[model samples]
Target: MHDIMFHKKIKKTLSTIEEVLNNNNKNIDFDYLLLDNMLEITFSNNKKIILTSQIFLKQLWIATSNQGYHLLYKKRTWICIRSKKTIKKILKKEFFIQTNYLFKLNLLNNI
Candidate 1:
């Protein structure tokens, strides 16, 4: 996809995530910052999750405490190239591990 299209997609996805988190802030306390094409989520425990879009690669990259995942748009979903897992699934799992709370994200509506 073109740079503009990729940026738009990333912006929409980040906005959706922010909305969801804001609506559920009582249950999950966190702060988020959107800088350029990146979203940085900081949990109450000081754990951080970063989501960044690579325009040239046309991929979304997610970084957590222990590892980083590069997700490519494929089959109507963003999936990890090595694990073949969806970004939403990975995020849910990672968030739960980091916060001991389930991360419920409805990516279908945004994507």
Candidate 2:
């Protein structure tokens, strides 16, 4: 994808995540910040997850306390290059592991 298109997709994805979190603020115990091309999420336990857009590579990168995932936009979905897992699936698993909270995030459906 072109840089512009990649950026637009990233922005939309981040905004959708932010909207979901905002709407569930009362039910969830976490805080988030969407700055520039990064989304930073901090759970109540102080564990953080950072999602960044790599414009040069046209990929989305996710960082948690233990690991980092390089995700490529493939077949209309963002998938981890190493694990072959969709971003949503990774988040669902990681969030539960990190925060002990099950976050049923379906970014693709929202998009």
Candidate 3:
């Protein structure tokens, strides 16, 4: 993918996550901060899950307190190259592990 397209996808994905976190359920267990190409999610227990765009590698890097995953955009979704999981799956699992809450990531369905 072109660098511009990769950046756009990253931005859109991050923005969608932010929207889902803030709008859908309003879970007080966690809050999110979105940067240019990164998302920092802090849980009430002080654990964190980070989503970073690696433009140089054309991938998304997600890190939780206990694990990390690298995902590449494929067939309109970001999928882990090794695990073969979608970004939504990874984020959902990590969010639950970090916050003990299930996030309503409805807007991210298309990503």
Local distance difference test, per candidate? 0.82, 0.84, 0.86
How would you encode candidate 2's per-residue C-alpha lDDT over 1-111 as one tens digit per residue? 898889888998888878767665766788888999999999888999999999898999999998999999887778999999987888787778866667657645635
By descending TM-score, how would the candidates be arranged? Answer: 3, 2, 1
TM-score of each: 0.89, 0.90, 0.92
Superposed on all Cα atoms, the candidates' RMSDs to the truth, in angstroms, are: 1.6, 1.6, 1.3
Index of the highest-TM-score prediction? 3
Kindly report which residue stretches of model 1 are placed more than 4 angstroms away from their true locations once superposed: 108-110
The clash tally of candidate 1 reads 0
Off by over 4 Å in 3: none
Name model 2 segments beyond 4 Å from true.
none
